[model samples]
Target chain A: MSSDVLVSVRGLEVHFPVRGEGIRKKGAGVLRAVDGVDLDILRGETLGLVGESGCGKSTLGNAVLRLIPSTGGSVHFAGTDVTSVGGKGLRELRRRAGMVFQDPFASLDPRRTVAQTVSEPLEVHGLRSGRRERAARVGELLELVGLDPAVAGRYPHEFSGGQRQRVGIARALAGEPDFLVCDEAIASLDVSVQAQVLNLLRRLQKQLGLTLLFISHDLSAVRHISDRIAVMYLGRIVEIGPASAVGSDPQMPYTQALLSAVPLPHPALERERKRIVLRGDVPSPSAVPSGCRFRTRCPYVFEPCDDVDPALQPAGAAGQQAACHLHGVVGTPVERTPEGVTAEP
Target chain B: MGARSGAPRGSEPASAVTAGTAPVLEVEDLRVRLRTPRGPADVVNGLSYTVGPGETVAVVGESGSGKSVSVLALLGLLPARVATVTGRAVLQGEDLLTMKPERLRQVRGPGAGMVFQDPMTSLNPVLTVGRQLVEGIRAHGDVSKEAARSRAADLLGEVGLPDPKGALDRYPHELSGGMRQRVVIAIALSNSPALLIADEATTALDVTVQAQIIDLIENLQADRGTGVIWITHDLGVVAGIADRVLVMYGGRCVEDGTVDDVLERPAHPYTRGLLGALPDLARPAVDGVVPDLATVPGTPPAPTDLPEGCVFWPRCPVRGDARCEHEQPPLVQIQGLDRHFGPSGLPHRAATWCTEPTSDTGLPASGTGSTALGGDR
Candidate 1:
């Protein structure tokens, strides 16, 4: 693992047992939401995970934070392996990490005031001494997220969508965690309010020197806040590179298509740009395709793709890695293909 | 002109040149007030717009900005007991507001079809996709069951649904979100309505699927000359599909112009704020640094209790003048600009206001204590 890496995940997999009909077939099937995936998040940097729904980006994030139990693999956070920890050690692991959810309304306690919600973290961790001190800390946290300190008395229902999200942020920051996993934090917000929340998150990250794992399906929002982006397809990280590099020149076919699919705000550019629209919906996770999961919809699929699943390998640019057969390693194709193998697509 | 001449001819799209004549739907001074527990909330203020034949007018607004309510009022979709709708919606030369319920029902699917945001809510869970499509088709026209079924199959295929035959038997829940959306689109285009209203149609689907649906709509519009009203908050999608853009804020059209004019050189403060707030993926990194997003300070006013004068005056950057505070700004047509502004000019127009331009150039930053935040991500 790199010295700068704050969170190191290796071969992480999360599988949920599928239930059948009413209640008869309890353990009928296994849905592998997050399959063999490896990622490294540098300290104080936002690593964005972008993919469509059911692609396991959220599962991967939850696994890293140990919010959900990982069926396989290891997640090393700070100096301890999160997967191996339990009881007191697990509580310690949680103290150093926090999660911000997608829906602020659902995530927050409707009955609890903003202060109670924010102060609960302080109480759980036993961070601040005395009731007065904790109340003051709660106000400070609310202010940090650009909310009025007086708003600490109001309940979740009293605040707007943006204000409720700020309260959620304040609650997350109350723990003073080094690592934060924001799972589609702004997905539910309006466009105008979306920007405000994004700006706030960025400011908070820089001010607190917090390491963040910002997972979202919205490519534009992810690109705006992420230092490095990892494009997930099915359950794997198909491409990982600097935000600018990936945004400008994506090596993976899935990454390329995902970027192209995003509609640019400018009308002229939107009309001019050609889109590589993927065929068919994303296949069910339980019945994932063999070899390469993306080959079913991949535009540049070849014979090698069906027979062998490509692993993340170095690409043309530094600090960039792509899991694709097109970027032949060492100026030669990695897999020896028979004649006419490339003509299949 | 109570003519049914512009009904579906063939699958081939109508010519773009024909779009210049009569607009498919013309709305004038549309207002919808909902009797909520709090009070009579004016959801849709006096709004007017026209969708020309084969033209796509994208109505962009945040939630509760009356974008959806305005369309619902035009279509008579809002509940009569709860909503008091007053508008003149002339569709194909007939005013929808004055039309009888029976006449309006005939015009709904055949005259103006609609595709909603959530496909699940729009579709029946128990009924098969085939049955629903056929029902919609046969409801408007005098078609046999066999003919309707075949048309449904063709509609499914046209929307790019895989295995149209097998999909017809499957229920709505059996299909994926994208597939269900396609089914919704298929049903919407069953009778080839003159006007198609898609309210956040692709908002629920994945980006890749959204692209596909967008392409399908554009293609269908081209072949059928269907005037589309795409109501959505997504500026990016609006840029790609809309011929003209209508920006709604605080239950009114703050700005209206061509997609190029509005997006590239926005004149209204709210429109400018919306464009500025968006995080552009195509935006070049400034000296290898991610810029902080500019935000419109303060939340939108409550619909029931909107501030006097300009609806956006509370959040407007150049909002210190007495005229702006006491009197609402009329939607003035900008001469030679090929666009319309609420009251002010571009940032250059801000220079004429009381406050001096704070920024280096004529573009005056909003004086509402709003900061342009940028940071290296």
Candidate 2:
């Protein structure tokens, strides 16, 4: 309910119905993609959401933006309840918020030119008057994203993967949205080009004071662009904190395992570091394990982990919280003081 | 052990594969020209390198850099009708380039096994996992169906698959992405090939799963002394698994050296740019300071229309002069600060290229040089 909070999500859930098995029952079961989750995005800051595939990171992002219908809970954006809005109100909500998808090729219309694609948002919201003014705005949007306005005539196929992504960004910014949800925006790009797009997003955020939600599986990239980090696991936020604290001193066991899984670019560090490789692949959402969803794969699972699912609590660090039963355990290492300052390891 | 007993060993003859001596696979001046409508486009131009026994040489490059194409050409994977590959590729003292189709087919499975990028596409959808693995094993060996099936189950167990026997009956779709990749690896190692060509093998998998697969490959390589060619764009994976690194740009080996030398003190501008572009997880994030990721400006040149001089000159931040535009720089040994010049009378090595921006230019040296990197380390 803070004034500075751009998007506030509370117990957001997105569940899909499992289709019929063979010729039997049509609605066999429910696949809880994004089971109860809560998060907040502050104005003008990039909150990175990271998790492996099937972890519901993308589902949560989509639900927040109202692109996907949520099964339960609510998403409030800029003082308006996003989940309840409809018709004009929903269109207005969309105008104030936009989403940039992962695959540039699939997200963009192949037949449309850069200008046509970008100008659609303006036309949808009735932002600018006349064809000429919308065209001018499209030019500005392209320029803002570091693409030459001259390329406006070019089709999506003509531009490279990175350039196509830039066009997507331009389209997203066409409505002049205050909040941007980039779902794995740079995941499909090359490393060098990923850097370019990441820098561009940061620059645009600063220039426009835009609140951004960057959802990606690339931990290094999430660390680079995000001011705050949120780690999702099996449709829930397990750890949330300042990027620095969460990345370096992760409180949750899952976060620790995820960070350790990342291969450092430095050979010496890579060779020296010992990684905690998790045991198995993520369990199917339809048949999620009882109690904590991560209990099946948790390396340090204890008795309580399988009995009581932990909730996010202050991890004794500034703006840091983790959902873990072993937080107070003697040998768990991540103990917090009364003031919420984490004890140094 | 029936599969292993009857089949030719994936490793070369003991005399041919002496560790640390001669390389198991030596590719010299390898060129791959694809027959497009416009003309013959040289996808892989004059590439050369070697994979030593029990050694892992990581080939790093962005998409369309010919890292995969060059290796495919070397292995005769490219269709003969579409690609004209000319090179001297000697595998265990035998010329692979000129070898007959029949001989190459015989060498492919037991001699050299390949694991491709997408595990889903690499596997047969209709075929059960056990059937595929068994078929792959029997392809290179004269073994009974039951023996092959047993060997396939053993291979599955070796890859750390849970309920290995149960997984054998499941189809590709029944497995997770990570499990599919493990199945691919198991098939690749069915005959214990001496040379393993993994082309972005784990790129499609999640980081956690990627780590497990990498460990599996490392353990297998350690046991069998298999020479591995890991083609990937991910620098982090290259740093983790490779003994030596080959940074490819525009179908050429831009830089080649030990992992420490290439990664820590990257000589080539492209390599430096690649390293710089990667967001370092090791570096702590600082508040109020926006760390601008250093990026290489232009896209890689098209194969048909490459630059007249250095392929990288167009995007090189420290490109020297008109000479760089006219002549290609050769790879010169860079042990010391002593400059080694090519026939064009200009320093050709990346080490020399690194020094050119600082030593000669009166302008304060930009941050891509070895001096800036040394401070970073």
Q: What is the TM-score of chain A alone in each candidate?
A: 0.94, 0.93
DockQ category of candidate 1: medium
Estimate the lDDT of model 2: 0.82
lDDT digits (tens) for residues A204-259 of candidate 1: 99999999999999999999999999999888899999998888888788898899
Please write out the lDDT profile of model 1 over residues B53-106, one tens digit for every residue: 888889999998999999988888889999998879999999999899999999
Chain B TM-score of predicted candidate 1 relative to the true chain B: 0.87
Candidate 2 segments exceeding 4 Å error: A24-26, A316-318, A328-345, B1-19, B286-290, B338-364, B367-377
Q: Using DockQ, give the best candidate's number.
A: 1
TM-score for each candidate, following the candidate numbering: 0.92, 0.91
DockQ of each: 0.54, 0.51
- Which segments of candidate 1 are over 4 A away from where they belong? A19-28, A329-345, B1-19, B336-377
